[model samples]
Target: MADFNYAFISLVLLLPLALLIFLYLIVRPRSVNIPLKNRHVFITGGSSGIGLALAHQAASEGARVSILARSLKKLEEAKDAVRLSTGIDVAVFAADVRDYDAISKAVDEAGPIDVLVVNQGVFVPQELAEQDMDEVKFMLDVNLLGAFHMIKAALPTMKNRVDRRPASIALMSSQAGQVGVYGYTAYSASKFGLRGLAEALQQEVIGDNIHISLIFPPDTDTPGLVEEEKRRPELTNIIAAGGGRMKAELVAKKALNGIKSGSFIIPCNFEGALLSVATAGLSPQRSFLMAFLEVVTAGIIRIVGLCFQWVWYDSIQKWHAQKKRT
Candidate 1:
């Protein structure tokens, strides 16, 4: 009996070890380190919030940074802030991401970009029944289509860059992108669209040594979040309350680090990391260890995800019951 127990324990230990070794050998698009130093890092929506923070972090890392936004004044302000903090002057461009012609002109003038950060996004949280069509269109245009416009404009130059080093295109997606949330109908759709774009774009750009990173930051303490909170539905706020907020600078630091490491899914906080693993799907993973963890934890993570759904639905049911009582 003792000998049988020992053999069963050995098998349990050996199974995981074998699995880890197998995963390390088969992971595709193998790990790469994309150097940021002396590279041109171009960011959109860099006038404020996470975009401005990314500009600062990139400049500090010795990259030639350029910021673009609709307001030239805010862009100038962001440039000055980076200069003050890092003593590095960043180029500023004024253009709306929704305008392909203007954004394309800006990209052409900025020259070949080694790193393109598509950080522009806008969100208005409301249930589909209550949300206006115009508001829905606005979110889709700026958050989803804007990303398309920026990438379409920069792809040619990025593909032909003289540096010939590994380039990066990082998209700023929200936790809402991973799972649908109450009252985030239009907003979530826009963010979710980014995942599809990143997945397909990676396949197209891999030959050019261009890597794609989809950054998933939970509720960040940015101006945009502040504005979003004011308009967020009660149920939306309740559903999102479980996820903690992160500072813009902290999120930017995490994002930049993930970009440098060629991480396809960059999660800012602990909760964001959990969301990434739970929604790994068929996304490219460079880290074999992470891939192993995803495989091992898939079943338990699904249960945890279901538990979260239960909690969220419970909150919704309670809120409706209270409304009926009132």
Candidate 2:
């Protein structure tokens, strides 16, 4: 009986391994690929957060980045940060991704974008029972419809212009896109729709060689997160928390790397990858495996952050007490 169990486990592993190897032998990895150097890259929501971090990283890799967002002041700041960090001149375009005309105008000004990163998004936490109509509309308009608008604007250049190499289109998705969260009724709907859109677009433009990459990032820290924490209500804990926020720079790095590699679905971190697997393997109710893992990761990070906060507060308190005593 023990021998039978061992044999069963080995067969389960080896069967999949054998099938994967067979597929690999049939179609080997592509060797010739364009590096980011001197490439014209466009990013939505690039004025802050992960998009800005990516702009900085891409500039370091010798890519000319065009940062797009609604705020002109923020765009200038982003350009300065990228220039200071990488000594690469960054161009800023103030445009709302939700507006197709604005996105098209920005793309035209950028002059044939070789890489397009769709990162514009909005996060609203409302329980399904109490979900406001406006909240749902806002999330969909920004997260799903915004991505659609950008993709449509770029499709012409990506399809007809006949660039020397294939242009890559990257969409910023979330782990919530791949799996369901308790209080993410609107958010999950938009994200899931984004993933579906990217996959369908991948099929539409595969012949044109417009490489499409959908990035599924876990919680990441960004400039906007300060406002996020301040505005967070009770529902925020369930749907809006970063869940062990990774550095923005790291998320940006992964996004570009995934694009260059032609990865269809990019998981941002180890936890994201694990969650992706768990999402595929487990049933909805049995999704506690992924939930538990996220909890454990978040708990560790929170403990560390709280400890630092506590120590700093204590030191300040001690200094005050000593000054008063003296």
Judge candidate 1 at residue 29 and give its lDDT: 89
lDDT of candidate 2 vs native? 0.74
Runs with alpha carbons beyond 4 Å of true place in candidate 1: none
Predicted candidate 2 versus true structure: per-residue lDDT over 25-135, tens digit per residue: 543123225468888888899888999888888888888888889999999988888878778888898888778898889887787778899998888665677778998
* TM-score for all models, in order of appearance: 0.98, 0.77
- Which candidate number would show the highest TM-score if scored against the true structure? 1
- Regions of model 2 farther than 4 Å from truth: 1-17, 25-34, 233-243, 280-326
* C-alpha lDDT of residue 223 in model 2: 65
lDDT of 1 by residue, 1-326 (tens): 99999999999999999998998999888899999999999999998999999999999999999999999989888888889999999999999999999999999999999999999999889889988999999999999999999999999989998878899999999999999989889888999999999999999999999999999888888889899898899998887877678899999999999999999999999998898999999999989999999999999999999999999999999999999999
Cα displacement (angstroms), candidate 2, residue 61, comes to 0.5
Clashing pairs in 2: none
Best by lDDT: 1
